[model samples]
Every structure is written in C-alpha cells, then in structure tokens.
Target: MSGPTRRPTLRDVAGRAGVSTSTASLVFSGKGPVAPATADRVRAAAAELGFSGPDPLATSLRQGRVGTVAVVVEAPLREAFRDPFALAVLDGLADELEAADRTMLLVAQPADDPVRAVAQLSSQAVDAGVFPLCGIRDNPVVEHLAGRGVPLVGSGSPDGPGMAHVRTDEEAAIGLTTQHVLGLGHTRVAHVSMNLGLRSPTRAARPDDLEAALYLDAAGRLRGFRALAGDAAPVAVAADLTVGSGEEAGRLLLDVPADRRPTAVVCQSDLLAAGVVRAAWALGLRVPQDVSVTGFDGVDLPWLDATLTTVLQPGVEKGRALGRLVRRALEGEPVADVGFPVSLRVGTTTAPPPA
Candidate 1:
C-alpha cells in the first residue's frame, strides 16, 4: 500500500496557484490587495488541495484580539430564551455584534450560585462581557471580569463601578400599568412579581422579601407598585418568569373569596398576566368584568384572546442600546449610562372595575 498522502498546506496551494504564500494568505484573510484573477487562482488551488484556510488560533494570536464576546444570562439557555423579551434582546445584541464582526459566547449563570459562572468563564477567552438580562444585584463574575480588564455592559443588575449600563427605570416602567389601573378606578389591586431569588416559590410577597430581594428589577417594580397602590396591597411572587409560574401566582391572588380577590391584577411580565387571565377563566371569572389584568414588557401573546394593557418596553431596542454601549466601551470611548424609556399601551384587558 502507498504511504498516506501529506495534508495540503498554504505553501502547496500558493505553489499550485503560481503565487507567493503571503499573497495566498492575503486572499484568504481578505486583507491587503490582490488581483481578482490571482485571488480566483488561489481559491481554485485551495479547493483542489483541500486547504480550508489559515488557522483561527494563529490569526487570533497575531491580531492580539479574540473576536468573541461573552454574553452572560442568569438562567439556563432554554429557560431564558423561552421568554420572548429575552429572545428579542438576544437577537438585537447578535445583530449589532455581527455588524461589528464579532461572535457571542453565551454563558449561562446559575441563579443559585452566580459564582459558578466565574469558574466557567475563567478559561474562556473573550474580548468583552455582557450581562444581558436582569440578574442578581451583585455578581462575582463582575468582579472577576473587571479585574481582567474586560469591557462590561448590563441592564439594571450586576451593578457596580466601571460597568456601562442601558438602564431602565424599573420603578417608573412598572408604574405605567399601576397608574393605569389606578386611573381605571380600581382600588383593590394585586401585583405579581418575578422571583426575587433562586428557587423562590410562588406565594404572597412579604415586606421582608422586598427588603432582602436579590433581583433588583423585581424589587424596584414592587416598590413602584407599592408606591402607587399602597404597601398593604397584595403581591405574589412567581417561581420564575414562566407562564406556569404566573398561573400559580395568579391562583394565589385570584382564587379567593369574591370580596377579597383583587379587582385588578398587575404583573411584572406579560407571561404572568396571561397566566392570571387563564386562572381567572378557570375560576369562571370574566376578564375586565370580574378582574382587570395588566402586565409589563409588552411581548406579543398570540394564544391569549385579549390584548394586554402593558408597559411597552421594546426589548430589541433596549438590547441594541446595550450593544452600542458595549461597542463604545470596546472602542475606548467614554460611555455613560444610557436611559431606556418605557410607555404604557392601553388594551382590552384593562377596564373600569365592575360595580
């Protein structure tokens, strides 16, 4: 049997193409200037010799930059992406990163132990880091990455010095729905909050829970609702940001005696509000007639029959804002915290309370 043939190299391709190895490299990297015919010849030779391209490791070593950005999310990939708002933010972030010729290295940080993310990311090489969603107010990953001089960007959590943020006024944003319900003459209002910590159960929110909350977004929104609705207003916390959790939270607030049940239910997310609607229906309660429902993060819900009164958060735009902040930081520009605004969208789900 004949000896195995040697794998083709850049030198072999260049020789076959009648060009210098440097010229072959230029064609492959799309750098410097090369005639069209020369480039074509190099590609043909590469094809025949089965030479794909130069080594990525070599290229990165020479460039002094790894073109990957670390995108940190505080949940498992499937769980996080299940929320439409999360998907929108990710899509927008991916778009801008693609435009800048960078790739994303997704890092899912466990909520129970955020420090675990630090270990996972320690071995990875990334040009910058992003906390793309609302996570714990403080994170060990922030400190580790900051010590390494990684450019960091975030939205409303993992707050610390030197990190640029696309800040959302969580309190004012949730107030959009709270004020709307108040305007609709609903005095008996209930709030559904996203989980304030890892493995939190769906149950009534207590004053102590708000005081010790780890998730700032949820805490801020709860404060906003309390600010308008009063501190004694009933509030339920979801186990997670899921429809199922929302349904559970809804039952806690809605499955009560008619007189005690809140006339209007305001949720921190559309998914939770939809769940409340389902729970209300299950209990033979007609929406807007028995209970008015409102939500935050105006995500599209095709399965629900009624349009939701919600806070128009524009997740994609908020994501792009985060991306821009990351880009600016990477470019050595002085990036200040950017404020993202939210608006109230009136819909069929909210109406004047039943007489």
Candidate 2:
C-alpha cells in the first residue's frame, strides 16, 4: 500500500488547470476578480480531479471566525421539528445565516437534562449561539456560553445578562385568542397548554403547576389565559407539543357529559387546536355549534376543514429577527432586545357558544 491514496487538494486542481493555487481558491471562495474562462477551467479541473475545494477549517482559521452558529432547540430534533412553525423559523434563520455566509449547528437540549447541552457544546466551536424557540427559563448553557464570550440570542427564554432576544409578549400574545373566545361568549372555556417541562403528563394543570414551570413561554401564556378564563378554569397540559399529546389533552377535557364540557377550548398552539378539533369530532361534537376552538401560533393546517382562530405569529419573520440579531452581535455591533408583535386571527372554528 503506497501510504494510502492522497486526497485531492486545491493545488492538484490548480496544477491540472494550469493556474495558480491562489486563483483556484479565489474561484471557490468567489472573491477577487477572475476571468470567466479561467474560472470555468478551474471548475472543470476540480471536477476532473474530484476536488471539493477549500477546507472549511483552514478557511475559518484564516478568517479568525468559525462560520457556524449553534442553534439550540429545547426538544429532540425529530420532536422539535414536527411543528410547522418550528420548521418555518428554522428556514428563516437558515436563510439569513446563509446570507451572512454562516452555517447553523443544531444542538438539541432535552428539558430534563439541559446541562447536557452545555457539555455537548464545550467541545464544539461556534462563532455564536441561539435559542430559536422556547426553552427552560434558567438554562445552564447560557452561563457556559456567556463565560466563553460567545454572543447569545433568544426568543424569550434562558434570560440572563448580555443575551439579546427577539422577545414576544407571551402573555399578550396568548391573550389574543383567550380574549377572542371570551368575546365570543364562551364562558365555560377550557385551555390546553404545551408541556411546562420534560415528562409533563397530559392531565389537568393545578395552581402549583405554574410555579414549577420550566418553559416560560408556556407559563406566560397559561397566566394570560388564566387572567381571562379565571383560576378555576379547566386547564389541561399536553405531554408534549405533538398533535397526539394535544388530542390526549383534548379527550381529557372534552370526553365528558355535554353539560360538563367546555363550550370552547383555547389551545396554546395550532397543532394542539387541530388535535382538539379531531377529538371533538370523535366525541360526536360539531365545532362552533357545540364547542369553539382557538389556538396560538397561526400555522397553516390544510388538513383541518375549519380554519383555526389563532394568534398570528409569523414564525419565519421571528427567526429572521433572531438571525439578524446574531449577525449584529458577530459584527461587533451593540445588540439589544427586539420586540416581536403578534395579532389575533378569527376563523370559522370560533363562534358563539351553543344555546
């Protein structure tokens, strides 16, 4: 064996193309002026030699910056991305990062063991970090990244000094739908909440539940709903953000005698609202006629027949906002917290309670 086959390098491509190695680098980096034909020749040679261009590690070292940003999500990748809103936010963040010539390094931190993320990130190098979604109120990663002098951005969780955020008034945002259903004369309204933290079961939420809530977004929205719906209102917490969890929460609240059932169900997310709608149908209940349903996060649900009444939060825009903040921080600009606004969208799913 001749010391294993050597991998093709930029020099190999440049030599094959009869050009300087610097010219080959310029072609890949898309910097500096080069003639069209010369660029074509280098590309052709690269193809012929199976050269994939410059090494990112070497380039980053030369630039004095890693072209990667750590995007911290609260759930497992499969579970976190299941929501369309989450996917949209990721898309927007990816778009903006691409514009800045940066890449996203996804880091999923389970709520049960948030410090695990700190450990995972200890060995990784990133120019910055982001909490792109709701997470625990007090994340250990915040302290870890802060100590490393890495700039941090978030959308309203893991709050601490020096971390810029695209903050949403969660209480006011949830109030949009809560007030909508209340305005529709649905007095016996029930609430379906996303899990307060990891391993939360699908069951009624007690007053003490809010005290122990790790997810601030869920807690804030719950408080908003309670403000309008009252302390004694029937509230169910989903085991997770999934439709299955929502459906289970729905059954717990809706699978009861008509007189005892809530006239409207205000859910914390469109996915959960859709699940509640499905559960209603399963219980032989007609939406609006029997129970009005409203949700937060006005995500598109094409499969559901009735459009949901929800808080119109533009997920992609929020993600872009988070990305822009990161870009500013990385560029040595003084970044500040940004306020993201939301609106209430009324849909056919919500109507006045039945006679």
- List TM-score per model, in order: 0.93, 0.89
CA lDDT scores, all candidates in order: 0.91, 0.91
Residue-wise C-alpha lDDT for candidate 1, range 1-355, written one tens digit per residue: 9999887889999999999999999998897899999999999999999999887877888886789999999888898879999999998898888877889999998888788889999999888999989799889999999999899999988877789888889999998899999998999999999998868679888769877898999999999999999999999999988989989988999899989999999999999999999999998999988899998889999999999999999989888888888888888899888899889999999889999
Model 1 is weakest, by summed lDDT over 10 consecutive residues, at 198-207
What does candidate 2's lDDT look like per residue over 186-302, in tens digits?
889999999997685798997788899999999999999999899989999999888888889989999998888999999999999999999999999999899999988889899
Model 2 has an lDDT value of 0.91
Best by lDDT: 2
Cα miss at 324, model 2 (Å)? 1.0
Among all windows of ten consecutive residues in candidate 2, which has the lowest summed lDDT?
Answer: 197-206
Clash counts per candidate, in order, are 0, 0
The alpha-carbon root-mean-square deviation between model 2 and the true structure, to one decimal in Å, is 3.0
